[model samples]
Target: MSSRASLKANLQLFVTRRCQLRCRYCPILKGDSLMPLATALKGADLLLGHQSGRVRLDFGGGEPLMNFEVVREASAYAARRAKALGKDLGFYMVTNAVLLDDAVLEWAAKRGVLLEFSMDGAREDHNRYKSAYDRGLDPYAATRAGVERALRAGSPHFVIVVASPSNVRRLAENFEHLYEIGVRRFDLSYAIGGVWSADEEKSFFSQVELVLTRHARELDCGAVQLGNARQRLEPTVLNSELMVDPDGSLHQMSEWMFETTPPTGEAPFHVGTLDTVKDINSLRWSRFHSYYTLVRLYDGRPDVRAALLNNISFGLRVGRFFRASGARLGKVPA
Candidate 1:
């Protein structure tokens, strides 16, 4: 493995597993456990201490707003620590936006925290999968209101749309609807671990093309951000993006939810604990880091990178299916 002396790392802090909404596609449903303030600060310290350049710290969870106070304190601490260490820091939060109100928007705006909302398209499509536990609560309406509030407050925010079988056909319409509602930026993603039928796959690509064609101007002008398209077009070396769990355990961003038992069965994805480890140099980390470095070495060849990502995604989907089936059959090892 090469020296990570100059590499900047992105840290995702899963502040809490508590969320108010019951989104059908979310991997984590519910949990009362919240990351302690001390653990949150420690995780920030670990990232700042190990990385050299600008460190992007993202506060995420079932819903980060459930523990907004901790996020605020930790962000302040991280800002001070980064200043003292002569490193740059970027703060972000991922939320469903159901709880985003004027006060929350103002707080985040004042602190320069970039907010990203998980909204699936327009009201009808969005309500199809995401909603509150009460069943009567309208998640789509709340999210729309929240976005409007954020725009009124002049806060920096963006939208993330998850493309599933149900919503694939409406992708273009959704993008247009969001644009009509004053959302200028977007991050589009697709669901993994599901087998797409022939017709579904065709529709997915067609919708993607339609969206790209309709938004070509915005995309070219840098007003929109499509995660899947960007990955496919401009592939970069996967940097060490660390996911710090609520318990303060460290994991790769890709292996965030599978910290206990990675699907690969090679080894636990547990790189180290934020409380005990001073530096991240575990074998697993080293291997992944080196692999990404090699990928970057082929930067000019996007086909190679695309193929790599496709293969990896396929393998992960298979692994997910196997694990799910095993649990269903009572064959998962205890």
Candidate 2:
């Protein structure tokens, strides 16, 4: 890796494993246990000590609002600590929007929390997974209603949509609706739906690319625009704050960061608990760190110091298994 120092700006923190919505694609539902609140705090402390750059933390969840107390305490704690150290802490959460009642909206607004709501496309698309058949509320309507409530409460609202093949064709139309409703920042990501499989991802990636390009073209035409005049391009897949799992495990991205099935059968990764900084330190040179370190090394760019510490036992076996396995399976028909 090149010698450029690594800068860690955002932390994506997962606050809980319990969620109200049963989205088919969520990876946390596959995990075993939730991390305690004390453990989460310790992980935050570790990030502060080792990582350089703006220290922004994002509180994520099975439903962060479900653990509203944790959300409040962690954000407030990080806010105070970051400010005293002359660093900025950005706080936010991703939710299904079903849980955004008036009280929740108010609390978030008071704390300067930005809310990212999941919307598939239209009523049918949005409700397909959110409402399913058993729970028959209109998720599309609920999301719209919730957005209004949040905006009314003076909270900044962003719309994040996962594009599936079922709704890919209507990307522009759905986004236009959101833009008209005062949602300026649109995050578009490929849908990782249903069971995780290599074959499925191949097809999903192609479809997502096509849909994303189509939407990007509409933005170019300026048919619908955010009220802001900064002239920024819409973010297709932006980096978010680090995720703190219920177990106080630090994840670089969303809950999906822990989605791996280890070859050694050790399960996925967890950095450490919040109360003990030692768990955080013990994670040094573990598979987690090795993963990032190898990426930096292979990228052959300005090298950043690998703060990702992982246990070689788990990471190394998993590494060789994946590399060899992928090659062997590459020629198999998708």
Candidate 3:
């Protein structure tokens, strides 16, 4: 599908705010509440029942697998709904894979859900930043176990190696290690919060070039798809990323872009919810989020205002990197 089509068809339904890991680079809102099964069922029905045709549903959250029961049953409900209506349902769940159990793996294979595994390149780097809150537990070990299991099960999977200041220079090395471990699909993700220096950006681009060169070199052996390099950029609003919080409140993807926690004290850009939004196509979307809006909306909280500004800055840097490289809209391959 075209980038615009993808933007139009996608929906991010967050299952739970609870996660096992307290990653240094994560900015997602955290809580113990899982999206009620009724909410998930309703959300799926509302999304798939629409006239939009094929629906690509990404179960978003603080480790979707942390809320395993909801993820399992809700996904099944969506599949059944789609089949009954003769519609295509592209199911996906992005996970740390720490809680990826046998049942989830089996369900993914049976339902054709594309499982996106977060293995931040090298083990040291992964364990360093992507570590669980419990220091004794090695997140890398669990990630490796889950990924290897998925590989053995013939589960559709991809590796998301985040390139942050902590490990931007080691990206190529991490990429190599992952490729050695049967990672044919890669999303060389850039950490999207504040404080990327000019030097860090330069190093990041250089590492990306090296990784691309390696991919080109290995083409004769087999296809190793670089997920971000193969996208088509476009001027878009909310279609590409719309997240429904566990409370059934819907917001654009940008509102959650931060590091460690939500800076605004509350989520921004709440478009609508499943309760009231019958047609997503009818929602009013525009350039509603900016520094000006932040200033206006967050007059009382300077710290919140400052953090949000940093987020915007970081986002623009990533955007410029993609625009300069001409990777269509900087999406991880549609």
User: Of the candidates shown, which would achieve the greatest TM-score relative to the real structure?
Assistant: 3
Off by over 4 Å in 3: 1-7, 219-222, 232-240, 259-269, 284-334
CA lDDT of each prediction against the hidden true structure: 0.67, 0.52, 0.71
Q: Supply candidate 1's per-residue lDDT for 196.
A: 51
Q: What TM-score does candidate 2 reach? A: 0.63
lDDT of 2 by residue, 234-315 (tens): 2211122345666554554422432431222232334444554343223322223434523433343222112112222222
Model 2, residue 271: distance off in Å is 4.1
Give me candidate 1's TM-score against the actual structure: 0.77
Worst 10 residues of 1 by lDDT: 325-334
Q: How do the residues 1-334 of candidate 3 rate in per-residue lDDT, one tens digit apiece?
A: 1223333466778999988887777777677988988888877876775567788778979888877788788888888889899988898888988877788888888888888888887778988888787767789898888888888888888888888786799999998998888888777776654556778878988897787666664543336766555542322111236678899987766555532442444444456788987776554343344333344545666765665655455555555665576432233446
In TM-score terms, candidate 3 sits at: 0.84
lDDT of 1 at 31: 76
Q: Give the lowest summed-lDDT range of ten residues in model 2.
A: 302-311
